[model samples]
Target: MQRSYSPSVRRRRLSAQLRRYREQRKLTAAKAGAALGWPQQKISKIESGEQKRLPAAELDKLLDLYEVSGEVEREALHECARLAKERGWWSKYKSAFPGGLPDFEAEASAIRTYEAQVVPGLLQTPDYAAEVFRAYRLLPEGEIAKLVEARMARQGILNKVDPPDFVAVIDEAALLRKVGSAEVMRTQLRHLKHMASRHNVDLHVLPFAAGAHAATSGSFTLMEFPDPLDASLAYVDTPTSTLYLEEEEEVREFASMMSRTQSDALSPIRSLSLIDKIIESSIEE
Candidate 1:
């Protein structure tokens, strides 16, 4: 199966490869830009993947300059450049995701998520997602629907041919907290149980007994890519804005926090049981 690639990953890969080529030729960004008759900063941007879209003609010129002779290698990088330019599925609903979480999720090979208040976005049901949007009060009713659709679209990663390895550690409060209606919550719990059964997904619940854990700060997601060439990133969602942390130390700290929190959480089997109890209580009510 052809590995599905996200634009974000492709961009990073392309930039890294270009930098390697330039370095091998002993060319600085300025010298390279001079030779290509482009601004020096443009080279830096291209190397940083900030340019977003690299024209095929320009890519061809760069490949020629790099003396990339092997047909296989050339074609691979050409495809990378092409994918980097293509917008992710979520990009269509631009207003919904200003921070580009979808782009990161699209290419993530593994994701470790911790949620304190509600279901993680990837596992949330449509009704639950709508309620979340409504509660935020940031979007009008019309815009909320579009955002919900976009959020649902992000879940597609879990069902793709080669899905990411997803592990979620949720606080006990999230299970007890009501999102939409009782029915919506029930459906969400059931969905979580089903998702946990998937080989790629591991769901854990941090019980109330495990009070004041490492992640008391709030919810965050640590996304890791398959290619070691691409760096891991951590996303922290706050009330006002989402912070995407890429600095090596910060990402490592978040990763360590997730690991510690997971240690304090209920095992998958016990977490499922807790969910079942909650589901039963909801039914009795």
Candidate 2:
């Protein structure tokens, strides 16, 4: 079964709710912190969704102080507290390799990914993904295989009854990286070409000449959902932790960044042509 709460998403939701209650009561962070016997910075972090957990007793006290006495409100806050303490499947793999942000990414009904450095994980082949995992140099053979299988499992969502639309924007450099070997790259490029033809998949390429674009800040994925009121999410993966941006302003900024990147990227047909050219080059090698 798919999990419901991602750490980042949970943090944002809890933070937003806390801020809302505090604002309704006209409580400043300093005042609230003083009342709760906590540091103002701690209150700020919780309000901003940067903190992961709050002590259960502290949370109960904050809710009571905020006058959030409704049964529904109390239940929601308790649920957040519960999620904060729960561990995810990825945690087990964290000791071997940094876990992916698949929990939130999977929840998206539409995914827009920009890869300036490498192939996006969802579209990668098993061989190519193996090579990418090897670069980490921290995972054992069994662990690497398990991780790759987990990644591959994520692809099943694309084939579901109502699959999410996927738009991938890749840079010219990613195609030229020659990830595995000549043969492996050739096969991976062929796989991408096939995926590009899917009705739900839109693949585009940012040519080498289209330099200094908005996405130079590295790779990111903007995920949209079917729920009209549910805010879209932006995902950024780092070596240690994955960040999820759910606030309206942050989501809008990432959306604009995607628009700029897609505007300069080649169309799906042209992207296929470029992939074909890369495949031919790999063959000649």
Candidate 3:
């Protein structure tokens, strides 16, 4: 059977649809809440993916209020309900995952990521990943194991028969950072070298010489889906909360920025050489 989705995943889909419906009808959250006899805060919570569940009756009423039509739209809402109630494998490790970061990562079909500090999670080796997790210091041992396993499981997507295309633009600073021992760093770099050879993976490195780039603001990920009907998503991770941007114009802007950054970065072949040099230097030290 297909794996069930987590509640947060369901919430995100519902929230996006609800926001689109409201915008199409030119209704603000306050105005919609007023019409439904619900608090504005509740409406906002639902839209932000903070509210885990909603009453079926309330959802139906809201759909009617928004004047949503057609069987497809109606079926979308029903799917949201089913996904919301379904239990995902990750649900068992709720104590480890904060918010819905893992869920979002899992659902993404094509991930375009730019990292300024450290290697992206999907490319991390088990030892390097453990060190990174140790930095968090929020979860117990069992929970940490579960979290690590979930992260490793996500890598399976890269090896699937029809793997998602991955385009990563990593900063030179990231390669220079010694997260673990020199040995661990060497292994990780070698692993990256291997991944770069994969047809579905494209690795680029933004050299220090490429100063003052578009991604100087921070790291972000743009995820695209197979279905043309689904909107592309842009994710910005912060210390406290993660921002998920789905607005067509905003996502387009991020895509443009990423393209510019990638153009400035070294090609896959040169990126591997750079990483190798960094690893050798670290080993020499």
**Cα-based lDDT for every prediction:** 0.90, 0.81, 0.81
Which candidate, 2 or 3, has the higher lDDT?
Answer: 3
Model 2 TM-score, 2 decimals: 0.77
Question: Candidate 3 clash total?
Answer: 0
Model 3: per-residue Cα lDDT at residue 116? 94
Q: Which residue ranges in model 1 land beyond 4 Å of their true spot?
A: 1-4, 64-67
Clashing pairs in 1: none
Model 1 TM-score is 0.90
Please report, as a residue range, the 10-residue window in candidate 3 with the lowest summed lDDT: 1-10
Best by TM-score: 1
The deviation in Å at residue 35 for candidate 1 is 3.5
Query: What TM-score would each prediction reach against the true structure?
Result: 0.90, 0.77, 0.79
lDDT winner between candidates 1 and 2: 1
Consecutive 10-residue window with the lowest summed lDDT within model 1: 1-10
Candidate 3 residue lDDT tens string, 1-285: 354354655677788788888889999999999998999998899888678777788788889988987778887787786688766666666654555555655555789999999888889888888777877776676666766787777677687666778999999998888887888888888899999999999999999999999989889999886545456889897878778898989999999999999999999989988988887787778
Per-candidate clash tally: 0, 0, 0
